[model samples]
Target: MSITAQLTDSVKLPNGAELVNGFAFEGRGDAARRALFHNGHELEVYDLYEVFSGERAPAVVFPVPWTGWDRGVDSVSPDATFAVFSGQRAVRAVGSDGKQLWEYRHGCWGPELGHPHTGDEQEVCRGLEHGSCRVSDDGRLVWAHVVHGADEYDWQEYWVVLDARDGHELARLPLGSAASGSHHVSHPDGLHMGLCIGMGQDGILLHWARWDGKSLTSWDVNEGLDRILMDVHNGLEGFLTVEHDGADLRLHALDGAVLAEGEPESGDDENPAGWDHCGGFVDTETIIASTVDSEEEPDRARHWILDARTLRVRGGISYPTGPIASYARPLGDGTWLTYDTRNGTLDRWTTATP
Candidate 1:
């Protein structure tokens, strides 16, 4: 789809600047560093450090080759450094000035069925390698999922933890022997890290383990549900998980605890499958979800705001002319920002007073 932009609420930037990848980095201080991908040729890294750090601009723009697809970034060393993973290689860059420090390349996997090749051998070759990456809260360690090799015949998965200072390989744990999926998230709390496995055919598997600088404890989960939505709190004390089982949206707590579950009061389409992508946790007490009514005369998508505690719909808005690529992230300043990848633009909005 083509990238577009639209304005929803009365939230505007100082110079109407657009922010992409709302949480590109972990901490608030590093969020101001704007990373933008223009066309498929150039990747621009803008240092908004001056806007937040109150320092003079000393060479802020850095350019890197674009790989045509969305890239993921995770901060290491408590936001002093960042790990940028795209295609099959991971590069470490200094966060303060956007300087390349180190890089690592994981070899690609060849073609096979069920595992139908995507033509871009380099991208497809990783064979379920680290689709995502995360840094430890203390900034000493970095962790990611490594799909050793998963052809149509066999399935093998593992977690790779690396030393952040240098590109040193640390530990690899074989997970997904019981299940296989592509997505994973690490909730950095005390000594434990939480993992979420997104099963393409089966349901999602949730697990938790302790990270002791080198080794990892075993993983455990309470429930095995499909279409899982996950978000960990800032403190990492607990997390919010939501699942849509065709008809209703169920919300749950970490450790397999069912905190609250209910159906959408409105905006749930007859084919309620797209709820997972268009829905996420805005906060502990609030959630945002979207649905499209395709059976109608003309298909259209609508957004809904729900109360996390009551599992009730509180507000909603219909997008009759445009499509929504993602939900909004609460900015803690009474405004919300939504990234519409379809238009290649970011829109900011505000909540109405009660």
Candidate 2:
């Protein structure tokens, strides 16, 4: 049966704050918190905590360099001391005061890789294609997906792990995929991270990696599927993935076995409804997913609650308020976030008991 989504709490973003790739919830249990990068005149981080208890200001704020578009997909450390920007040509780390902590230069992700005649800071801001970066749970390591060389002849994309203190390349794996863009899904254990490389129509590449102190080991999980990797379980047991075409959602074990699959029933067989790439474990046994893209009208998009263990759709989540945006981000603590793109407000929601 369907459950109502009760409004619990909310926090308005700072003035002039424009979200980059929306906000993310990190940590688990009491240590859980939210992190978001807002790009306006410059990039800034808003690390928020205790939103449900009451309205809280950003616990930490870090300023980053470059425009939001040029930053590719950036991530801030859990402690909010630094932010790593996955750029068009480099993955850079910057301190709260905008000081450059470290930078790892790589091949350009720009479409016009051959047009680069001079090397300058602005040169890294010229492309629309790029990768993403994320900090480990402990904030000791930074995982990045970058093009491996500076020239066309040797250009290749790789998943690299770097020492967070300094930009020392610790371990790397050559990703044999032509990436239009990519993102990393941080495993709760801190040692393992999942990468989803989007190659457009060519299909998506899913890779799981583990860092065991000395080297980085990785393997392919989705051999021939176009799945977009989502969140990992709180216990590090398995993760979630939705197909690129929104065909279905699958729960994959740590070893890459499909435990269960769920495809919401479509009203019209001619236009089968599918889940959006956005969604995650709401808690240990439940999930919050949306089908906003399946609807032609923006307000008609809906979110659904599903059985995380079996990938079974429990029911659609009804908002006491009006319709939300296209995505529902779960915090893994039974609470999820819905953004109001119009007013820049993030509302926390919890499903009411039936």
Candidate 3:
């Protein structure tokens, strides 16, 4: 399958803060303008917020409560009515008006435990090195990798399922922790989700879960694995990953099976600086893979589209270079998005919708 997406629209971020990874679309049908954007440090939801559509100034902005010392599981609900903030110590559900709905005491950031690592306690747990949170599709449940920091040596991860409506505990399973903060990817199936953790020397851990009506079922498919997840396939359950510090891009199944694997084309004797470490599934069939600025090519990162089924390069797409990081964010309508931080603009690239 050859993928061709054309640039059709662009929007300037009103806050001027750079986007984190990508944007989130909430609500359904005509009301889907509510978009969730990450301004690096915090996730903000905007009313009338479809940045790709016609120009409509954000009516209001709701910022999540964040700790200067810790990273939280950050996202908004599908309806854009409620915001979920899974912080260092607790998870708080806030309303669009920026009022707290309820709070659940989950765990502590290890620095507060008075341990030492690469940095100070506060400095060590600076980014999302602990745990994170996400909401279900119907806005009924919340999934969390709740970390319980016991000591510098024994931090445990509680695979938690929560009631999104009332902020109550639904179920908790101790996924005997390796690293504290593992990033989670949501599935359209609602009952499914995946978590990927990258522990520097300890290796990578991949987890997949599904609610089987009675309880949550999980799979830690890290046996004999070396790469951390670079992206989740657009299908919601599989993955697109790179070997730890290596250049081989792999497509894998939820059960840890490598479906297809290869690296971006490069010249011989060329020590390519590796990928800009970005890209993702454009749809059920296409993966948008890109390279970061190499020492050899600092001007721009190369963008390549891949067939998710065959893991084959379909074609290459183009976008104006950016200052922060070059990336491709597929919008799932035979189109993808790119953020040119240098010019502070968001662009939508699409092929004729099939």
Candidate 4:
């Protein structure tokens, strides 16, 4: 029952070259404006417009270079600002329109105990595993994960919080000692943030805090869940959806009380291959997940859509030539706008209609 709509528009740059990174649509129907980020020569932004006859034109353009820039735009701030992290640099920009509002540069350090070697043997190790930059609801604070030094193999971890107004360091948290699979979740209130500290190299630890102007209160969730997805419903009621190894996917009250845990009508096995570089969220009760299949075996690849609430398989789509990147964001009209980087296309589909 899912209906899909495709919108195609190419952004023309200054040098007669066309720039495309898939259009990011905001709003609904005719009120919607598609945003394009051009990776040509340098990273530039463009505001795309549709004319009276359905022709598209570039309304504005600008530049930004924050490396290792990944998805999760909505986590940055609803006002068109984007959070980006690369190497030892973390920055947030108001798309291509505004300059870098804040930036944190980390000095180089040697490798650590549990560090994994990448690239050729002669190259210097870039210790960044995964870093995310996020903004507060009021656009007053920006949060980012900053990993430094070459000692990534050891148990030392550090992160920083920045003042979104002046780009100043507000506080720093050092996750002392060892472990793997550490994840972070920022509450929709923008005043509170959570750190899921994974211990025993296999267990998950939950720590919550309030990002007051000066300090943080240490609150811990004792449930010992493995994985957590925070503010999944766009910060509606502060409820968190959690997935654990032995337990079924459950929704917990913001206070860490289990609300509901059972197999929804759309449930399915949480496969291993799906977890790699995959992320999605629940819109109301519909859980949307986007995953890629990458096995060493030749010609084996595809993507999937699942009901996050029911955990049931809704549909499966294959990317034959592989995609450069893909992202799904919940629009207000009960539909999702997917950006497929492989073919530079934007597709809109409704979960309710599916």
**Structural similarity to truth (TM-score) of each candidate:** 0.65, 0.90, 0.80, 0.57
* Per-model CA lDDT versus the true structure: 0.48, 0.76, 0.63, 0.45
lDDT ranking of the models: 2, 3, 1, 4
In candidate 2, residue 275 scores what lDDT? 79
Model 2: lDDT of residue 137: 86
User: Which residue pairs collide in model 3, if any?
Assistant: 6-350, 73-133, 130-181, 275-292, 276-291, 276-292
lDDT by residue (1-354, candidate 2, tens digit) is: 668998887777544123212434446544646556454645544444554455455555555565544446778788778878887767889987878999998877764545754655664445457799989988999999988665667678889999999988999998888887887888877788889888877999999999888877889987777798988866649999998888899998888999999987644766567777778898988998887472244565788999989988898887877676547777787887776768877677888866
Best by lDDT: 2
Off by more than 4 A, model 2 = 14-25, 50-57, 67-69, 111-114, 124-126, 292-296, 322-325, 341-344
Q: Write the per-residue lDDT of candidate 1 for residues 255-347, one digit (tens) a residue.
A: 556666656554435644344343444555666655543222123455667776665777665343464545444432323456544444446
lDDT agreement of model 4 with the native? 0.45
Clashes of each: 7, 1, 6, 22
lDDT by residue for model 4 (1-354), tens: 232322333332332112111213322223233344445423333333342134444444434453343332323344545533323333444454556654565522335466555643223344334444555556677665555555544334555677766668888777542333344555545567666544554556566666777785555665545654533455354444445442334556666766655332322576333332223443555544444322221232333455544455565543333332444444333454444444445454553322
Candidate 1 global Cα RMSD: 7.1
Question: Candidate 3, residue 251: CA error in Å?
Answer: 2.5
Stretches of candidate 4 exceeding 4 Å from the true structure? 1-102, 107-124, 148-155, 176-186, 194-207, 218-224, 228-231, 239-247, 264-282, 289-329, 338-344, 351-354
- Candidate 3 residue runs with Cα over 4 Å from true position: 1-5, 14-34, 38-43, 47-49, 66-70, 112-128, 149-154, 176-180, 230-237, 293-297, 318-325, 351-354
Best candidate per TM-score, number? 2
lDDT of 2: 0.76
User: Taking the tens digit of each residue's C-alpha lDDT, what string does model 3 give over 284-327?
Assistant: 76777666543235465567777776767676554333232446
Better of 1 and 3 by lDDT: 3
